[model samples]
Target: MLHRLKEFYDGPNKDAKKFYNLVEEANQELYPGCTGFSKLPFTLRLYLLKCLHGWSNKSFTSLLKLLKEAMPELNIPPSYNKTKSTKIDACLNDYILFRNDHKDDDFCHTCGASRYIQSTEVDSELVPSKKQHRVSAKTLRHFPLIPRLKRLFMCSKTADSLRWHEEERSKDRKLRHPADGLA
Candidate 1:
């Protein structure tokens, strides 16, 4: 593994080799991630994750040196020797992108709300869960998405007969006379 670590060269121009996801689009400009310390740039943050995944601290430190030799802008090279405070603080904000914490039900998939609507809600069938998910028969085999299906209930595009049952309470409240509030 040490031999391969020193020799491995995954770069943008080299499609034959696969770079880890964090570093896959290093050169591309991402929304500036949480301001991390160690003065390391976001791209270098990705590089460190790749190194830490497999290599030990000592080997990672050595590898960081080699990377430093190649790219002057990479800031501090991988430092397995650094204090835990320094190492931990350095990666604090960069993990946000990895976790995809921005998954909001309200603004999902801006293109056309891919997940929230179905053409035919009542007649739609549940997709069978992949066999890999079967731990025990007691576990839910197929959970149908109903709330997402509800959005289409309001739209009468495909189902001409579908009716939106709206309670006429809010409209009546707005039309009430001011004298109703007298004590």
Candidate 2:
């Protein structure tokens, strides 16, 4: 495994070969349940590698094609089309205020109001747990923006700019970045 890592580090065209091997190795190492890439029911490891590398579906597809040819012994997923579509469908399963139907019956049963219309309202602590239960399960998984913005500050390149809000504030200041928050 050390040899593979060293060879991978020194290898030319590092993007193509090393990524597949590393993903395969990591999958086997991390997940003891699955035997290897081919045996796993889901393409979770491949998806996670793409996420960690910040590769787009198209770029991952190209890499996957290269892997299929270079390592015939490895059983990798064929294309990104199905994988991407499935991910997209999963993400899109959540309801959007602007896009989804808002019939009057969708209102709160007790208050007869659309209290859960805005994402902020849905996520707010002010909303009772019982009321929260009234929200659609799909909408419950709506991704929060604050954590994602905070993650930007976690990166080395952006960490220096963590205090940019304070440094660059105007007289009529408004919250533009996550760093502006007291938390």
Give me the candidate number with maximum lDDT.
2
- Give candidate 1's whole-model lDDT: 0.38
Q: How close is candidate 2 to the true structure, as a TM-score?
A: 0.29
What number of backbone clashes does candidate 2 have, counting pairs of residues 3 or more apart or in separate chains?
0
Candidates in order, TM-scores: namely 0.22, 0.29
Model 1 agreement with the true structure over 1-183: per-residue lDDT tens digits: 877976785445432233333233322333334223223244346456866787676766677678667865555434645312211111122222111343232223333222222333332245454232211111111212442255345457734434322332233444364433434
lDDT score of residue 67 within candidate 2: 79
lDDT by residue (tens digit), candidate 2, 145-172: 5544655676776876776556666535
**Deviation from native of the Cα of residue 110 in model 2, angstroms:** 17
lDDT for 21 (candidate 1)? 33
Per-candidate alpha-carbon RMSD to the true structure: 25.3, 19.1
lDDT of 2 at 69: 85
